[model samples]
Target: MLDNNLDTIINKTYIIDKTPLNEEKIKKVIISLKDSIISSKEEITAANAIDIKNHNGNIIDFSIIERIFKNINNEKIYYGNVTTLKKDNNKYYGKQYFDKGNVLIFNTGNPYIILEIFLKNFLAGNTSIIVTTNYAYGLNKLLETIIKTVLETNNLSPDFINLLTTDAPEELLKNNYANIDLVIALGNKSFQNKITNYSKVPVLLSGYETFDLYIDEMLDKTFLTKIINLHLPMHVYINKNLKIDLRGSMLVDGVEEAIMQINYNGNGYSSAIFTSNDDNAANFISKVKSKIVTVNTSPTIERLMDIQVKDLVLEKTVIYPNKKKN
Candidate 1:
């Protein structure tokens, strides 16, 4: 079944590459998708409920649903800010950004994060083939419907997003016939490693095996617990029990030690430090090696878009010498 769809999906992306989506149309599609999701909340929840039950009462499924609704509005903010290069000196130099074609997003059991990654690709005008496992069939089906309607209503290609629910995602990953330009895999180290090995194309990874939060000194145990609880559910770094069981939850000697631990052991996706001292926060934020460094605040759902931005598009630098015709 996937083999049959691969050609059509690749062809659709070729059409998009030739005739790119304008900013207005992109905005319209995003708006429609957000509205559709809001209107379909109850149905979405119901669909996710089945996934949860199938996964043996995985409460994380519900959390994914809620996060989607909570963060849907934030998608609008990403529009109108597509960066471009400015002409410099006598050289007509600038950069051009283009959408990657046919991104295969592998769902590692959480529909919400996959959906978030898909929208980032959508915003950048990339066509996506979202491969979901059987556990998330119901939720993904509903999302596929909602997104397709939005795209068609905006007079865009419905093939811009494709959802394939298979028990074995590796089959799709290993398929050489598909014109897959990139693969976005959201999972732990083992899952990411498998996808990386299976994919013929380059793989962009989100989520993490271990994420760290470093503290200079021990605070109230209650306060530390609150910090962990706030960031735990939103991230894959924590386990199902909601305990900060791994490397991220640790006490350090000082800001310097905290910075070193995070830089060495962290996944470079995100890291946070909670401190009232401006000097410590500044030092930590500046020195941390993660893509996102925050002080006195945990990473929020809004930052998810920021972290995944680089993986969504392709960039090229253009340079031309400006010479007067004589």
Candidate 2:
């Protein structure tokens, strides 16, 4: 019933530029986020209630994160060791070394913490540090803290740390190819094409997706509606079906909007779920009990399903409903 183009759906939403907040504002934001999430627990529980699980396969009441963030104080959560590095290039193979400190990486149900630790250790000896991830906002905050810590500890210039941005893996390789000593790559298959057959620096590839089970549970109803709306504009009925469109980015916004809506206690419903195939849809469906109906041909959906599924899951949300039937 919707007549809007994919372009309109994507353009209407803001992807990156959420206003910058100061420390006090940030605290308020966190509080608001926390309150919203906590308030939604009852609705989420009633919507798509499923048994929580852990690595050991035991049924858990709630995600470990709920306790970590919900109950713990911010100051306690931010506590970590401070490392001061005396400027010494000789100690680290002629690269000027700043401070080597340990920072805690929060668990979002992924190995990014491990990756961050590895990179921190790997870069400790070097004079400079560079971090790259699809999470530009998060990367910016992390870099800000690292810069602040380095400047405060060593009393040096603020520009000591450099930040760079690139659109794809090839761009990353092209810009920093031989210059990079250690590179940590996040997200799986999307970067494959961009990283394959390259003689670049060491690349650590983690799983293509990381699921926030808590957020997913909270956004279940919104997700169903958005998925239906997205395909509806194309005259597609995705009820336990798979729909593939080249306009995957458009769907990304819808998913994020769904999450923001649920997380912030807004009326908006968005998630980051989209795919070009059925297998991936099947995987998500199996996990979340949802369906999709697309107008795309079966063969086309099959071709892009896996990569699409992997990419979608990385941002959170399970794949669902593989193929649409005419």
Best by lDDT: 1
Worst 10 residues of 1 by lDDT: 233-242
The number of residue pairs in model 2 that clash at the backbone is 24
Candidate lDDT (C-alpha), each: 0.64, 0.30
State the TM-score for model 2.
0.30
List clash counts for every candidate, in order: 1, 24
Q: For model 2, how does the per-residue alpha-carbon lDDT over 1-326 read when each residue is reduced to its tens digit?
A: 11222222223221312223123433443344345545655643432222222121112223533533432232211112132333343332111222222111111222123223322332232122333333323323343444434443433332223333333335434543333344444332334334544525544443222211111222245554454433211211122222323332222223334333223321111112345445544444334321222222221121111111111111112223334456
lDDT (Cα, tens digit) per residue for candidate 1, span 188-307: 445667788888888887654234566543444576666566534322222122333444345445777667766665566677666667898789888887777766455442345333
Worst 10 residues of 2 by lDDT: 303-312
- Stretches of candidate 1 off by over 4 Å are 1-20, 56-90, 208-307, 320-326
Residue 213 error, candidate 2, Å:
10
What candidate 2 gets wrong by more than 4 Å, as runs, is: 1-161, 175-179, 208-326
Candidate 1: C-alpha lDDT: 0.64
